[model samples]
Target: MRIRNSVIVITGAASGVGRATALHFARHRVSLVLASRRVEALEALVAECQALGSRAIAVPTDTSEYDDVRQLASRAVQEYGRIDIWVNNAAVSFFSPFLAVPMADFRRVIDVNVMGYVHGARVALERMQDQGAGVVVNVASIVGAVPQPYTSAYSVSKAAVRALGVSLGSELGLDRQKHIHVCTVLPPTIDTPFFQHAANYTGRRAVAMPPVYSPERVAKAILRLAERPRHELVVGRLGRSMVRQHRLMPGRMEKVMAHQVENTHLSKKQAADPSSGNLYAPSLDPATAQVTGGWKGRRRSARRTLAGAALLGVGVVVLADRLRTART
Candidate 1:
């Protein structure tokens, strides 16, 4: 579908990948409806989009609430005659051992990450069905496919998001709704404020792991999916490789991922106090509203890329040897 002059709604537009996506679409001749809990940040983003020569509005929304999502959809149609694309990108994460995390925090992560996307999809699909054409791009994490340690709730919510995309696509297929498409994007560690904004119960600080891709990269991938809908897209090469390895050796991959998360995903030296970061309330810090989290750089990317390649190469060789032994 042509992006120009189309009406696009993006959730979590205040920061991270969502913010980057909004700015990206703003370059095209598209009307944007930006949603987020941070009213000030959304307003700022709206001005930026407008400056880029796009028609845009800021809608302060809590996507976990069905009524809020419904109003968001209504507002989009009220502003623009029709909805063309809906991006389900609003999500929150918590880093903690399963037993250590409070039940409330765990539920909040599910509510915002899983139920938030559900609310957006429900409202977006209904409106799109009426129009007979639309696209829903769900931003899930690679952890959805290859679960990591210390983030059980986040992992579960992302996996549910992936499942939601599959079920919706199948239902649409059965109903012959060929024009309305649902696409799921799975990104690995991304250089976004997501790590800083996450609720952390682990004693160590949460960090964007090695080989972290820039938010802009993920944003570009989201734009591509919106223009040409695909069922599933992994944003990074390392992420795609990890997913394939997990599929080939689930048991071994789980152990490897656990180790990776423990050593790299969380800071080993930096201690952090337990706090519910942006789970219930919007982040007050202006710094958290930017697209990049200062984790991506040429030197870091190159080093991490080499490390990841070596690890994947060893895994491939081990898997090949196992296959040969089994054949013998």
Candidate 2:
């Protein structure tokens, strides 16, 4: 399945990996139905893609809402006549200790991460089945592949996405219309606003994760997945290896991730400041093609390129934690 000129629906398209993927497909002349909560941001992306000669529309959407997602699917089909691919990338994270983690935060994370994917899956499945061919991509996290400390709810949600992908993949294989493919993408902490934006109980600066990847790399992997139609893709090599290591050496891996949870810290946290955490999704500062690898779109975060910078910036090298996280 070629990517060029195909109609694609991408959730979380306002920024991060989804934004990069949207621009990537646009570069290839794909028609796009992009959805996100940020209407201005989505509109900006659509404008950029249109400048690149792709027909793209921005739809302000809350994936957690079933009707909104169904509407998104319907809009894509109505505008483009068919839905070739659907990417579910919207998500939230919780960083307090499991017992202390707020129930509201936990529920919100589940609703957006797990339930959002469910909505996308349900909508895309119907359209794809009717069209006789289509694809769905679930953007999960490597944290869910194996349990880590402080992010218990986030881990649980991601694991559910992985499980859902496995289930959907099997179901599609056995379905009468075998062209409906289900794919999941699991990546480690990428250089995005996720750290600063992640919900935390600790009052301080953003706690860091291990080495992170560029959203562009993950976007490229997703584009490849769209073409090849794989069941699951782990973006970062180290993240993938860590998941395998955890499976074989649970005790050791647990200790490692435990230390990570303990060591991460935040820059500035104010319990009194009532700004909603959702206001700060991981964002990118899109630069010239020279620095960000040809993605000169609006507000895109560049992955660390220098070996030392990459090691230092990503959550991989940092263990300093000023915040709290939920445990298993």
Candidate 3:
């Protein structure tokens, strides 16, 4: 798909990966239909994109609702005749034990992360079928493939999202709708506002897992996918490696992820009571949408990476020992 002069719709456009992606596409001079719950941030982004010499509109939307997503599609077509690309990037996260997480919080995470993508895909496919071509990019996560501890709701929702993309792609192929592409992006822990907005129950300050990539990197991959769509893409080096390692040694990889989750995903500093941050409502702070989540602990990523390497080393030694014993 030619990005220049194409019309694209992006959900969760107010901040983080979505915002970075929007700016990236804006550089290509594509018309943009931006949607997010934060009206003020959305409006500000609209102006920013417009200043970049692209036609853009901000539609304050809660993507968890089918109606809101449907309306977004209608508005995009109404303004730009057709949509060439649609990106499902709206999502929420919950960091808590599986049993400790409230049912309401869990349900809300599923609604936004899983159902939100479903609504976007359903509406985009309908319009694209009539138009005879379009691309749908779903932003899933490596956590979808490799679930982590204390993030049951978030991991499950992401896993479902990845499945949704695979199923949709298969169906589209079966229906001979090759021109309408469904691509899934499985990114590693990114430095985004997602941690700030995630509902936390660990009684510690929330932080993303280590080896965090800049949101711009994921945004760039998404832009590339919009140009040449693939069935699935893993964004970061660590994330891609994790997927391969998990495939080869599931139990060992699980232990590595659990170690990272326990040591990296939470701050040692004491935090306030558990609250569903931005799960039920939009974040009012414009700063929440910044590219970086402002998590600056001393060499956190380096330390975590070293810890992961140590775990891998131990696993290899244990395996070698087991093999020697079996041979003897």
Candidate 4:
């Protein structure tokens, strides 16, 4: 797991957590193959990584296409001679009620989010099997474990990602491929452009939920996984708390999540006209490729801190009541 000098392949490398992760590994002297649909953004990220002293290249890729992903892996090996780690981070989402969402948009989300990861894993693992050693990190979400109210397709896709990691890990173990590993990372609401880029149909502007952590934090977790692979890692304190609550009280947690999504996941004061954000095409705006989403202001940070603490307290009380009932 020595990351220094390792060759890493990252999808969705143009923006958000993927961008942050690329910069992080660049500091460690790793060779990087960055992929995304935005050629301009990917080229910019490659320049930045090169400035940071890493050997890097940008591959314009639409991960939903199996051929594009296959070529990406081939390109990585062609350049670096070997793939040490493959990170499946490319994903798209939509904010809509289950029935209200257009079938095409929902399917697009699945294609880019779920099948995108599938293609990445399949190609990455195929190459890794030939090498006989490599790690694959799948970026999932906390919503995967605890479903939200409106973003049904997103939740389903993320849950499928988690399941895919588990199944892949089990198969590797069964086949006795000890050196090959698949890791899943579950992060909470992150300060990223994902909210702005997601296709919206709820008639409201989407927003990152409270207690939003920085993309850099998730990048650090991913870096740790590359150094020491684990089956699953949950980023952020609030995310871990929510996952624990869901495990303890499934019915109650679902109710709480529904309320949370309805009240806070979207802007109550602002209305949005329906538009496909970046599901079908990458955003042309240069601003869409940055690392942070301007969501980490001081006031919002303070508010999120208080909100997270309150939610954690409520979870504790709910679990205590459940335990008491069991005893009775």
Candidate 5:
């Protein structure tokens, strides 16, 4: 469990939460196998980790391919003589109505988000079974626990992750082959290029959610979990509240969410590629703190969203009869 000199394999290490966690583990002197399709970024991350005095390798892995995942495990074992921990962190997102989202995007999302994690868990379990101990960590989202509008595919993929974690954890508990453990970490929106990199079915991207937690906060939690494995951990009070509210009142929650989406919708605007797609340049390292100026800007935008939604919902309710009559 000690990260110091422990061997760990992480997927999607090119950016975002994966990048942050890789650096955090490196700082703790953990040996690392960092994987992603972005060879440039992965190499940079590997160099960073090595500079911190940890043995590391950068593997260009496409998690959607089962063979690629298998090779990832084999390469790590070949280099380190064993695998200790495997983290499934690669994922993609789409924002739009389910009916409008393209089939290609849907399939790709499933291939990367759901099946990728499944592959990691499967390979990690096999190696752990051989060694008599190991750990597997999955990075799901708050969406795994609570569904939201404009992210049907994204929500479904995360929900699948939640289901897999619980079921696999139960199996690992009883398998008797080793002390292998499965742990899931769910974090709210973080200040990452993820939103910028995500695809949009509606042809536009909404401004990211405010109060986004820094990736370092999530990384710190992962470090803690490594020391003491929990079945699951949810990050941040905001994420926990949303999950609780949805459970407490589904209908009211639906209405509130519907109003918010309608009022703050950016579906009409032209979409731009997310910066995280920029696999070049010095990547955004694990930030220790959130930028205050950026935080305030996002807060103001969020307030306008709330106030506008309340007004729009009231207007729609009052004008319902007139609008229906006109339709006839």
Candidate 6:
């Protein structure tokens, strides 16, 4: 669809991929509805979009609340007269072993990551059904397909998000609502403030795993989805490879991921005390809310990771052969 003069609603527009996506749509001269709990951040982003020659509004929304999400949709329609595209991008992460994670924290993660998307999709669909067409873009992570240790809740929630899109799309097809499209995006570890805002109970600093890509990449994928909806779009090379490898060799991939999470996803440096982050409430100070995570993640190449894993397997077989020969 032509983005110029299109109406787009983006949740979690305060920072990270949502912020970048909002700016990207703004550049296309779309009418934008920006939602997040941080009113200050949302206001600033609205101004930025306006400066780019787009009509934009700031809606302080808590996605976990169904009412708030409904109001967001209502407000957008009230101002723009219709909803064209809805991007369900608000989410929270929890870092801890599944058994060690608090029940409340796990539930909160589900509330935001999974149910939040559900609410947005429902509201958008209602308006779209009335209008006879619309697109819904869901931002799920690679973890949705390949689970990561110490963040079981987050992984499960993202997986549910992906399933939500697929199931919803099928239901729409059954009704012959072909004009309504559901697209899911699976992004790699991104350079965002996600780590800083995550609920951490691991007693270690959290960081995006290697091969982190800029949020702009994911934002670009979202824009493409708006134009032409696809079933699922994987954002980065590393994320795509990981998904393929896990499907091919689940057992070996599990070992590799376990090592990667324990070593690369956490920092050995002393970490600050654990907190609930924004899971229960907004934790980002409005004054400091920004897009980048300021995390200079490890500079490991995606090719190197694949090559190293292959070399390790070869070396293991050769060493076993040498040991057997020596024993003989």
Best by lDDT: 4
lDDT of 4 by residue, 1-328 (tens): 9999999999999999999999999999999999999999999999999999999999999999999999999999999999999999999998987888899999999999999999999999998999999999999999999988888899999999999999999999999999999999999888989998999999999998887889998999999999999999999777888899788778887887888888888899999999889999999989889998878822367766787787677788887887999999
**Candidate 4: minimum summed lDDT over ten consecutive residues — where?**
297-306
Native-to-model Cα distance after best TM-score fit, residue 3 in candidate 1, in Å:
0.4
Clashing pairs in 4: none
| lDDT on C-alpha atoms for all candidate structures | 0.91, 0.75, 0.87, 0.92, 0.75, 0.87
Can you give the TM-score per candidate against the true fold?
0.97, 0.82, 0.94, 0.97, 0.81, 0.91
Candidate 2 lDDT at 219 equals 87
Better of 2 and 6 by lDDT: 6
Write the residue-wise lDDT of candidate 5 on 157-263 in tens digits: 89899899899988876765446788889986676667655666566656555436777778887877777888889887656655665676556555665655544
Candidate 1 local lDDT, residue 246: 87
Best by TM-score: 1
Two-way TM-score contest, 2 vs 3, winner: 3
Local error of candidate 5 at residue 67 (angstroms): 0.1
lDDT of model 3, residue 209: 68
Q: Candidate 6's residue-wise lDDT over 105-189, tens digit each?
A: 9999999999899999999999999999999999999889988899998999999999999999999999999889999999988
**Whose TM-score is higher: candidate 1's or candidate 5's?**
1
Q: Candidate 2, 62: how far from true, in Å?
A: 0.6
TM-score, prediction 2 = 0.82
Q: Please give, for residues 187-264, the per-residue lDDT of candidate 2 as tens digits.
A: 876655555456776554454454556778788888988999898998866667667667755666666666655664
- Give the Cα-based TM-score of candidate 1 against the true structure: 0.97
Q: Candidate 1 lDDT (Cα, whole model)?
A: 0.91
Shift of residue 270 alpha carbon in model 2, Å: 10
